[model samples]
Target: MTRSDLNNWLIDLSEINSIYIFSGSEGLWFLISVVAFVWFILAIYRVEKNDHTSIEEELSNPEDLKNLIIEINSDEVDKNNSN
Candidate 1:
């Protein structure tokens, strides 16, 4: 209701637990951050391991190159229409 009431409520809430120990919400956030970081690193490693071919090698076939160009043009047209 009042600012002082809100401040006192916050102070009481903080005082309920010691700052040195991780609260449940803090621990959950830390776990999520660690998992996300590890997942990102693994994804990068997996991509590097699986992707052995260069761009030139991938598009060496004429048909593949033509299809890629057509796909790009279609995507561009769709984007332009959206705007």
Candidate 2:
């Protein structure tokens, strides 16, 4: 069949909705972007809907949590010598 006939047979102009399939690395990127978008939306939804511990109740100790703890004199340093 000719190119014109093939085109006409493949795509119908009367259809209200058209679906296209993407291929190759460009398609991979599109898929990745869609996943990332969904992930971000889910994260936002969870944050807004989930209940979390309050700041005052959560952080009672200054150096308790691994991530929140600060480096406080691991080695014995001269605290008396101010010079």
Candidate 3:
């Protein structure tokens, strides 16, 4: 189908009536509502916690990590002031 034909089909579908709510058993409705509420809360939390950090920040923050044996050996040699 062409782009114009698909666009016309979508426009025709937009005229149909759609009820967003379902009037079913109380237990089913409650379960669906609870799930939807939890999902919305989690989405909000992730958005708040997401931050962009630069690569420089990550590379410079390795002091908390223990250095390897080679680093320790180099430090000892430097302390002794050997060639």
Candidate 4:
């Protein structure tokens, strides 16, 4: 479609100020989009919160770091022995 047709379509959409004006499929899709957006935002928030808590716990316990380093070194040694 031409730019004018696209512009007119956008203008028409802008005139629709309420969800009730949408047809069945349009309303369903709009609701689905809103729900998906909220879910995405919540998921991101939860991930960030979990990461901060995990970091704080790791910092509070030095032994975890040492254990992690030991595991890494052991894995490297096993790889070297295999090679």
Candidate 5:
């Protein structure tokens, strides 16, 4: 958006007197919260991506996959019983 349009949107979204969002020094808190949320999502995505990549790499060995499946099932059963 143009500078004016961006400014108007920000004003509406984070107005000093608006009841929807905090104002004053809380502006810094709002910015930090947004950054933290984005970081958390990216971290989760990276972890899941790595897990899938590792599993695909390991799947190259058929015997290894069979063993891995047995291990995963055994762990699940153990966890269920423990809980």
Candidate 6:
């Protein structure tokens, strides 16, 4: 067809909902974004489950652990001094 005939056909197609395919592409983008968001949430959940020990609890109970280390170090120093 001539260029003017093709242009006329395109103009006619534009009169109806030209957003039919455009909105289809938009729906696809929304679906992809949703899937990516869900994947990110699941990854965070898994990491939290695997390594979610509380730092506050550990820090709160440090006195006993510190005493144990000090006792061990004293024994080591005594042995070295004796030798």
- Candidate 4 regions exceeding 4 Å error are 1-24, 61-83
Candidate 6 lDDT, 21-75, residue by residue in tens: 3443677899999999999999999888666556445546789668877999999
lDDT of 4 by residue, 1-83 (tens): 33222324336676655444333457689899999999999999999999999887876778887888899999999999999
Tell me the tens digit of each residue's lDDT in model 3 across 1-83. Answer: 33222334345676645424342355788898999999999998776656323434544646633354468788999989975
Give each model a TM-score.
0.36, 0.32, 0.32, 0.43, 0.47, 0.35
Candidate 3 colliding pairs = none
* Model 2: residues with Cα > 4 Å off, grouped in runs: 1-24, 51-83
Q: Residue 16's C-alpha lDDT in candidate 3?
A: 46
lDDT of 4: 0.75
Give the per-residue lDDT of model 1 (tens digit) for 1-83: 43232334346575464443333466788899999999999999888766755676889999999999999999999999999
Alpha-carbon lDDT, every model:
0.75, 0.57, 0.61, 0.75, 0.77, 0.70
Top candidate when judged by lDDT against the true structure: 5
Q: Write the per-residue lDDT of candidate 5 for residues 1-83, one digit (tens) a residue.
A: 23232335445555434344333456788899999999999999999999999979979899989999999999999999999
Tens digits of per-residue lDDT for model 2 on 1-83? 33222345466656624334332356688899999999999998787655454553576665555445433342224454543
Which segments of candidate 6 are over 4 A away from where they belong? 1-24, 53-83
**Better structure of 1 and 4 per TM-score:** 4
Model 6 worst lDDT window (10 residues): 1-10
Q: How high a TM-score does candidate 3 get?
A: 0.32
Stretches off by above 4 angstroms in model 1 are 1-53
Which residue ranges in model 3 land beyond 4 Å of their true spot?
A: 1-24, 51-83
Candidate 5 wrongly placed segments (more than 4 Å): 1-23, 70-83
Q: Give the TM-score of candidate 6.
A: 0.35
Cα deviation at 1, candidate 5, in Å, is 42
- RMSD score of candidate 3 (Å): 14.3
